[model samples]
Target: MISKWNILTRRKMRGVYIIAVFTTILLGLASRKFSHLLIPFIANNAGDFIWAMMVYFGFRFLFVHKGLLFAILLSFLFSFGIEFSQFYQADWMNQIRETLLGALILGKGFLTVDLIRYTAGILIAAVFDKRYSS
Candidate 1:
């Protein structure tokens, strides 16, 4: 399927990647600040997943120097960093982290599921990247 679209030719799809990354960062900032506006468990974690995927696909689209292993490592770093960020930053953000689904998605203080989900997300993005993007 990727054989059709010349996604990275003179067209310069860097803008797409840039938009994805920017949007991810923007959403994170929004979640941190406006967490009170979100529904208890669902919104934050769902946002987390989407954010992770956005960053993954954003980087995957932008750079040409990563593999599955690298992507997984990136995912772990991103997830772990975001989780750790919950400990000592963004008061409202921390509140959102207190929910059940939030714990499951953001993770329970520290656990493996978060990492696994990160890897899964990154793997999915990378597969599509290899398959669909030029």
Candidate 2:
């Protein structure tokens, strides 16, 4: 029942989201790798902020049909949930955290500041998406 234009728009949006996710990931990695060259505040916080932006883009890619508010809420829930999950110190979880991939995904430890970084990142992403996606 969808029009051809709607289908094309969805595909285009998905592609945009995919690119945003990868770009954010690269920036996050670069922030960590090149932290010594940057300001101390950005060096410490950019990775987390970029990580949250990547999460928002990823949800947008997956839920391309959903409204911007839906993506915003879902991204916030997901990012915050992952941050909170770090408080669980079960042996199995710790084992997973030990791996490089798991460490990147789940993070090594919970920091209160990460929540602020995530909130800012998500809000900024939503603002950009709202402004540019139309």
Candidate 3:
């Protein structure tokens, strides 16, 4: 029973989410590639923060009809799950972690501080989404 306007709006929102995800990914990679140019704190935390933001945008893209809170909760769960998964050290998993693509997706190590970074990132992205997505 979707109307034409509703479908168009959903497509537009999905497009915005896709752009957000892509931009966050670029920023995350640039943060790592040019860490020396950034302040020490940003250099240390930007990748994790941006990674979390990208996760939020990705979830938003997939669940375009979901509420903001749903996206926020799901993103936090997914980000935290990935962070915690780093605790497992099986040889097969370690091999995947060693690859460039795998290393980026599955971080090499777990840091408690990364949880804070993720929280901050998700909160910030939610705030922005709430304020602007209306």
Candidate 4:
């Protein structure tokens, strides 16, 4: 069943997943290095959301269906993963996350609240999956 998705997406999905993996890694690094300079306002968080959507669509539209669960899970994990990174960070990232934008994306210490946001992102991707499969 899912292999059908693999066949349809094989040409495109690999390119996108590779891109997403690279982008996510780069952004994760940036969050560690320049968190203070980048975070600013609520829009900062929205920007993160946009990135998530980018990843989600990259999967739904281009990637294989069998991989979707892991893709979405990785995206969500990326969110919290970056957050935990602050503990190891020097200070700049944490400072930036303190600002409205920083907090929106980088966030503070772990909170249960993050699960809600992750779920919302996943659901949005799932909706895209169900609606666009035709």
Write the residue-wise lDDT of candidate 4 on 16-98 in tens digits: 55565466546645654575786564323433444465556555444464555766776677765764565655577777877
Task: Score candidate 4 by lDDT.
Answer: 0.58
Candidate 2: stretches off by over 4 Å: none
| Clash count per candidate | 0, 0, 0, 2
Tens-place lDDT per residue, model 1, 1-134, is 44435544514555655665677667756766687888976454545555677668565555534554575567668766876655564667657678865653554455345555555556665676566655
Task: Compute the lDDT for candidate 1.
Answer: 0.60
Q: Write the per-residue lDDT of candidate 2 for residues 1-134, one digit (tens) a residue.
A: 99999999999999999999999999999999999999999999999999999999999999999998999999889999999999999999999999988988999789899999999999999899999997
For model 3, give the 10-residue run with minimal summed lDDT: 102-111
Q: What would the TM-scores of all predictions be?
A: 0.48, 0.97, 0.97, 0.45
lDDT by residue (tens digit), candidate 3, 13-118? 9999999999999999999999999999999999999999999999999999999999999998998988999999999999999999989988988989999999
In model 3, the runs with Cα more than 4 Å from the true position are none
Provide the RMSD of all predictions against the true structure, rounded to 1 decimal: 8.0, 0.8, 0.7, 7.9
CA lDDT, candidate 2, residue 49? 94
**Candidate 1 Cα RMSD after full superposition onto the native fold (Å):** 8.0
* lDDT on C-alpha atoms for all candidate structures: 0.60, 0.94, 0.95, 0.58
lDDT of 3 at 90: 97
* Most lDDT-accurate candidate: 3
